[model samples]
Target: MITDRHYEIIVYGATPGGIGAAVAAARRGRRTLLLEPSPYIGGMMTSGLGRTDIDWLDASGAIYREFAHRVEAHYTAQYGTASPEAEACNRGMFFEPSVARAILEDMLAAESRLTLVRRSELLSAEAVDGRLTAIAIETEAGEGEWQGRSALSADVFIDGTYEGDLAAMAGVPYEVGRESRDEWNEEYAGVLYMNFGPSKEVLPGSTGEGDDRIQAYNYRLCLTDVPENRVAPGKPASYNREEYASLSVDAAEGRVRSIRDVLNILPVPGGKTDTNNHHYCMCSSDLPEENGTYLEGGREERQRVRDRHRHYYQGLLWFLQHDESLPEAFREDAQRWGYAADEFADTDNFPPQLYVREGRRILGEYRFTENDARLAPGLGRSPIHADSVAVGAYAIDSHATRKREAAGRNVALEGFLGLGWLTEVYQIPYGVMVPLGVDGLLVPVAVSATHMGLGTIRMEPCWMQLGYAAGVAADLAIAGGAAPRDIPIDNLQDELLAADQLIGFYRDIDASGLMGKAIQYFGAKGAFRSYEARPDEPLTVERASALLALARLLPGGSRFPALPAAGAVLPAGADMGPRLPREEPSPAAYWQRHPLLTQGLAGRWLQAAGRALSAGTAGAAGGSVSASAAARASSPAAAWLRTDSAAAAEGGPSASGGAGEAAPAVSVGEWCALLYGLLLEARRAGSSGSGGR
Candidate 1:
């Protein structure tokens, strides 16, 4: 039997990006429907990704910020501080998967307009003249048809599934596998061969001749150290380690270990550790043979892959926990963390979905390439319109495509490449989210754009921001009676900027209003403020902490205080002294010449301030100015003093100011003096800022 329901918007996947998109759509007062093939809401976060590989937290938008806040709230309520390690292990922001699931579900429930259907699969979709007309879904109860899935028959449909299944089914053209350099004229697009092992031994089956070979995929496993909560490795019904026997043997022989071996273990406060599961094309458990086939495979074949992953992860666990071949210290450390009691109970201890790093990326009208990333020095202008949605920072990290052993050694290309550590953050245009010819459908994840582009945009926060943008575009399409791709760039830009989405890093700012609040928050906390905030620039560890401190979100108060007056200048022979090349310009000098960098700095400072204010400082008065003026004012020296004065003046509770007024000017020295006064005022007012003291 088939039943029918109507909704203004339909979001598939239930991944973090899906949840964000659904919430965004619902919040816009759309009659939204969120369908999850799995039982839980958070696809990765709540599955087993306790340790996050967040690339650009500085550029993460409100949707992601809300998610982070919930995580902080969970810890604060339980441990009185955001640092979980303070209560137990040295855990930072890691959380139990179940807790993340609960938070996402709770957030969904709070929105009365959103409908959540769990264990529901999108069987098929019907479109008319480029617009999605209806979708047929299968659930436990029975099959059902959803009509007007978006406003006016889904004015815009967002594909949030990690696998890009919906987009593929909808007849959208998408690309799978890496593109050869010849195709995109990109330096980093083709197959790369690198030596990852300690020695320079060349192993056969390790080198690749082409880029057709795809990277391996794996299930992110959640492990724990507690014996009572520990679950032993279980063999999959279709257990067959023979296929992987060679790799296992090599790993045992210390020739090749799973990426897990190099995992950067993030310790939780309570003695637990969050292990990151990274994948490379040639590494252990990457399952290269399983690429592209996941969506097309029959249920049995799919289950087989799942079984293989289970066995692989199980074998991995056994090796980590009890393998005598491993060093004693390694074995002991591996046994410290096990599955959390409250998470993924049904799977015995595994996430439901395998982390699909890349899927069928939609072949949208405009394909972003490395050229777009490195935009030629003097291209007339970018085909990428001004409507940008998200920012990306991760390197172009493509894994090996084949396995080989040669010259009595096994070698693979598994390390990161492209735009090394010093690469600037890249802006993702709204066009990447819009599909060509497909009127209603928009892909926020695993859709459209080049393979190299995916390297940076694959992070969770970036995905969430893209999802948010998709939702807003859907709303605009519904209200204005236009297709997603046809939603004028000007209108899209206005809405995105209004919503606080950082687009282009250069064009938007309400700096005085928000930047001041940020300065005040961090200044009062005695935290080191980055002399300048540039959105397009990659965030260094130092700057990240500074921003966190400014937002009052850092676990502890300022880690670095203002340098003593006498020691402010670089010491003679100091390696840390300014190391800019003689012919090259400093960041300050570059900002002066590049309006984009200037705008980026203004927007970032304002964004930092906005976060600080929203975290709970009262408003500071200031009038609006053109982004140009804000950009000009963000020069290093001026920016520092401006931020310093603002931070000093409103460092306390009950700060308020109306638009356009200068408020009150406090000199840098006077600002420092006011810090003590601000502390007293905050204490008296019982403000949250007092918590830092």
Candidate 2:
């Protein structure tokens, strides 16, 4: 086995996020080493978890888009582009496991500086003076280049495992289970049960108290009903009828209707479904408390854990299909499913990886909570995250952590939270990935977040985006000979922007353009609040004044002049904000139903504002815009997802930083862009928001 070599970056795990980190670092001219414990590389993506867990593909940035494109292209090339097969691909969001693996393999092949070693598991790690120094891994016997015990040393390391194995081995402070509600002030913290439907309502017996119990784990099975290719599942090697007794009861009660109710059988291309455990079911594929043993267990014990789940699920399926105790109708429905003949061909058509929903979450520089994903009481969007490295849009979803002790009763299982209630597209800060005293390592998949916080951040696409940022950050850190937290934020941000990765979310401006850059910068500086359609409807005089004022980082805020008693829009001569007319060359605030402030006047004010703000200190990305991202500001979350979802865009109230601010001449988008461009222009012209002399 190749060993005893020093590397620039060593990333453990072959998950999509790991690939993102390794490739990003390699592309930036770092010698990167990628190690995978299993023979597989794509983690759940190529391990039967087929339906993509993301909402907005456009905002997912480059690496995710590339993977999506390749998956779609694979089928489109075989079937005509307009064919149903191609349509079913959903741009690779719906895909076959093997195809995903092949595509990812190809992605890695293109990077010459990258080296990937599979079947390699980390055994031990060494950290000195708070910096990770070396790690020992044992690659299983294989023909592939590296095998057996090997020691690797790297300047930077990333714990990309679904379980924070490397982080734990390196003495990173990690916690297993949910935190108390009061600890992080998370609403869904601790033991809870909820009924998920049109609305998620918490059930009785839900205590806000914390526990060590974590969300359940299950394998995402790829099953198909295709006649010619279907392989009927035989009984598991260690099938136990009593283990599946609860399933039969659930079926009798109609809670388990068909195989569909028992599993989240989402359709993928080629007539197969990326089948996963259904949380709402009282008894299904999920064996809640069993996963805790696996999380804290060693490799051999974990393998046993994997085996137990596979056997339990297979036994349940067998019982549902054959037991006379179940209704014949239910049996017939269950009989329609069989292992997809094409997938997991080697493992008897079963997925190899156990879906470890969550693992060890390290204590980070920042511990994001459920509130971070909620709207700020007064702002238009989630609280502004100036240090954001990526964005998470999924709701705070967690599966049951424990089965009901009394199976016959209708009591909902504890710890099943499918609630998307008031969930917002929130930004993930760089602090979360940087463990509090640990240097030279970044944790992406098993990130630093509250259990509820993981609800939003625990999706593959989000991890890849964060991993991509970590990879770039590693490059910059190495170049500057500094820790990840100490590196220049602007340089890291610039690289991410250049790579088309989003650090900030804006609805109206195309993120690839210069306007997007301005919007992000100003938005981070406390300018824009909501993610609603670009505040394109002419800048209200009130909003314009607030934008300039916010950029200046003034302490107090001004309320909008009260609206006319009975008009649809503000009156032309309405008061805007404090002492605007007293400023040098300040034009009389016009009272237009639209565009109260034109671009010409905005440019003049911005020049003076920039010189003033910059002269004191460059707007700090080190902290939140005005309210810290941690602040429990109960601001009204503006409808940021409106542009992404038609239903959202059509509803919700967004206070555009001021009470009286609404439509009025330059678009807020245009103004931000114009203002930023002028700032850059002024910086270049050797000058700066004079209210136009």
Candidate 3:
């Protein structure tokens, strides 16, 4: 290992996030140091956890997308485009573990400014006055001893390790395990899963209580059904038959239905499989009891714990495949699948990285809680963060931590945290990446979040997105000669967008689609600011009408108003808030009465309105317009009444309540269209209706 090298950005833990950060930083011309404790570079992705669980819609960053596309391209190049491997590649969600590793390495190799050091551990971190100065690293010498020691200084440090080792060593304040519900007002926080099964024994902390226990850890097994790539199961060095005593009994009594009942064997490209533990299965490698201590353990201690887990899981696999007491069919099926000989060639086809679901999470500037992960109370989506750095779309899914018996059935607590039934997309703010009161440090992995909150943002894609953001933030900080927290968020957002990092979900509307021009038009008129517009969510009648009123006020052919920042924050009760005119009480009732005011009628109404405005006609059918309507319309409100009469005369549905027609809901895209139509008519008439509603 080279000891004389100094880097502009020092990244620890070569996980997916670390790779992303190192690449991003190096691309920006900053000399970067990427250090991995293990010999492998790709952490989980290379370590048999290849069945990616990603929310493709929210994965908008360039780096992550590029990585995904490369994986797809890899499969397509190796296998025919019409092959099953190509199909999985076309989907771009899952791939073989080795393929992912190769893609990451290729990307890393392209960067001239990156230095990769493997099998090096973080021995100590020197921080002065809440600012990290230097980090001491110990490179592995011959045998298990680390005789080579070196220290490096960097302008910025990024902790991309799943375990948060660098951040913990830097003296960043962090937490382990769940927090009480009261702490963050999180519904899934603290002790959960108390009454899930037959166990009467309460966790030391009662239900909904806080503790240091973290989610379970496991090795993602890369197996293969094809005999060509299969390596038969072998007895681990530390395996003990007694360790799987309960499993043997359970199998004999027919408690275990099938090997799949407890194992998640998801297929990847090239006939490989990414296998994980199932909730009801007795084959889990999760060592929940040792997790708390492991989280705080040193390298040696952690290695021992990892070894024990390996023995426990391997022993269980051996029992399932060879034990005579188990059902014959189950054993046969288990024997059909074996380790993929082509993958993880260095580790005898076993994954090198362990799945550390949760570790020491920094209590950063903003602690993202479960409340933030859930849908906004009144809105059907999540809130927009003014300082968002990335977008995350996934459910808060946490695995069980401790297993116990309840009512003669096995139960697990703090294992599965289902924060919400629906998978909602949310913004990850920049504040959470900045540890509280820390300087020159950014934590993209194991960020400042509650255990439940981490569940949603813990996916590999999300981590890579955060890593990209960190790299940009570091670049900006260095250029401005300022600390991370001191950099203006607006400027940072500018840089993020330049790097193709998605910061917010809003304004992600298609720029080339039908709504593109309309969104640009209304966006200029400041009409969308009335509410946090989820351009993706279905538009309610209330929002549709409000958008119309705002559009009518803008003069036809007038320049679009200056657009606000995508996620700009405004004081509560600001005039710019969605000032949608309040409808008569029972807004739903009014819509029911005038079904034509809903979605399906928007096109017809626009046509009629255009004709009425063109002819300068008013007072058709002699119905008087309401005073409020007259005050708001630049042209006579009688024109609207005439348009309604014209529609009625044309054998179309009348605006004054159709003949019991159903009110069709409008989507945000549809609302944009209607708004566009209205703007066009006003422009043709050369009139502008100005002022707030």
Candidate 4:
């Protein structure tokens, strides 16, 4: 009783990445179909994860930024202000899961070219001539088949599933687990068994215990704090707290203090907070172990694992909320948050899907590695020819693969470490999205890459950007009659650059001008008026509204539309860009007046600043080394100079000028010379290349 549907492009998975891919493909004028196993979309954002782990917010593409802007818009419309925390108890850029779902649905509804199918699961794929030709799917209503599902048949197939299920089903080779140190010559690879400092001897994989292995997995409960809007935590049918007894015991033993220990709390509008459990300890919910077996697991097994996580998290919540052993303060806080009354009315307020942190990483023509994470010399020279999609800047963060004792204590070494370079972001090569041996397959979520590289690239914003890029690539392939991997890099870059995506560190006037315009647009839309934007700046709640009004998220005409009339003191000309000294124009103004000129100036300033900081830090470290070397004519001074010189060569400011002061205007040719110089240096340093092959 089911019918088959055909489309120019089909995107698997309805997660954020999937949504982005679908939108991109559709925007590109391609007939795109999005298939989701669940009835709702927005994956984690609409599921239980009201919180978002976004790195390099500045580097995110237009699509992702617009999504965030929409979230802001929704809250503003609902509350007459964007402060979700003040109106709700959760407090922190978090929202009810239902809100996210509605927004996503609306987004798709507005798009005529995109068709969404829910409760549909991909069963198998048909291949011809080593290319995927069709995909067979089973739905609740019946069964259907899709032709051109492969690299050759369909111009491109984007695997946007959280688990990379489609990519694995396609028989693409991938990897899971920490590679040994020898594998990539990385300093922090394989099972680290050493403890650097004070720690606890909980279990090896126990969250926050500093175990030398990855942490276990658990659910991120989206609870409410408002009594009127809160729903009590419900026990899953297969609940088993005993399975987590060891962790509970660890809590009692002072090994694990609170379940919120590792929670990455993101503040949404109002008082609601979105809690994400992706780090070590606490609800260490990223299952590196289970990820490897995902490809082999049957539907039942997958559900079982999902059920176990739900039970575990529910029990943990129950324990914290009512357990007599819990501290009074902890219990009080735990009781304040429960499921929102108006959100996720089904499944007892739990997210329908688990957040899949890692999946089947395709071993394509190139592989991104720790070296890339380090931004090693010459890493980006023979860049993947695909259009540079998005940019990422988080440090390589991987959880422990297995529990192990280090220095007589159980500790999890898997955690975040900042990449030393500042204002330096990594470009996601187009090739990373193309699957090798799969002619039409394009992977945005679990693209071909190394585990280390994924640590930074796995963030939500980055994934969204990647999804956007992949969608564009797919459309190009479909229109040009070429494999995704075969698309010329120049063409891709041109298109991507036009789309305002940040590719490499080097920026041209055009790209910079576009970004400036975007910043202005966002400001006008009132998207940048969050209290977090200037956390260090002192401002009262009333002032906060004033600042937000500048971003146009607030009612520009009314003074504090949501606030009391007495408190709503509308500033004169509040609609104008942020107030600045007469001598110093706003960033928006600077960019607007001389789009390219401003971009060149800013780029030069940033590069100069980077060089200055590097020189200073290296100089300090070299002083001590210099003394020792002086004794033997091997002054660390020389080493320091070399390091500083190398950093300077890599786009750091020249030795002569301060980073803040604007340099004299240079001709376009001169600017290109400077950029070319840096590009060449990057190549010589081996920092530029198409990722691993």
Q: All candidates' lDDT scores?
A: 0.55, 0.73, 0.69, 0.55
User: What's model 1's TM-score?
Assistant: 0.67
After aligning candidate 3 to the native by TM-score, how far in Å is the CA of 373 from where it should be? 1.2
Cα lDDT tens digits for candidate 3, 1-693: 435556789999889889888988999999898988888887888888786766563345657878887887777777867888888654566888878888899999999989888888898998998898789998886424334788788999999999889888888999887788788787657666533333323343445778777888888998888998799989777777766667666677776767776577888888888899775554365656666667788877888778877777788788778878777888898898899998878877778777888888998988887777677777655665667777787777777776544522444444554544545667788888899867999999979999878988898888988998888889878887988887756456545654666665544665333354355345434444322445556665456556766655554423222211111112234455343435323545655544333333443344334544443456522322221133224322223323343342333332333442453444676566545544544433445344221
TM-score of each: 0.67, 0.82, 0.73, 0.67
Ranking by TM-score: 2, 3, 1, 4
- Model 4: CA > 4 A from native: 1-4, 81-96, 142-153, 193-216, 235-259, 262-266, 278-292, 327-329, 377-387, 403-410, 413-424, 505-665, 668-693
| Candidate topping TM-score | 2
Pairwise lDDT winner, candidates 1 and 3: 3
Tell me, by lDDT, which candidate is best: 2
Better of 1 and 4 by TM-score: 1
Q: What are the RMSD figures for all models against the true structure?
A: 14.7, 10.2, 11.6, 18.7
What are the per-model numbers of colliding residue pairs?
45, 19, 14, 66
Model 2: per-residue Cα lDDT over 499-519, one tens digit each: 888777877778776567667
Q: Which scores greater on TM-score, model 2 or model 3?
A: 2
Q: Which of candidates 1 and 4 reaches a greater lDDT?
A: 1
lDDT of 2 at 197: 58
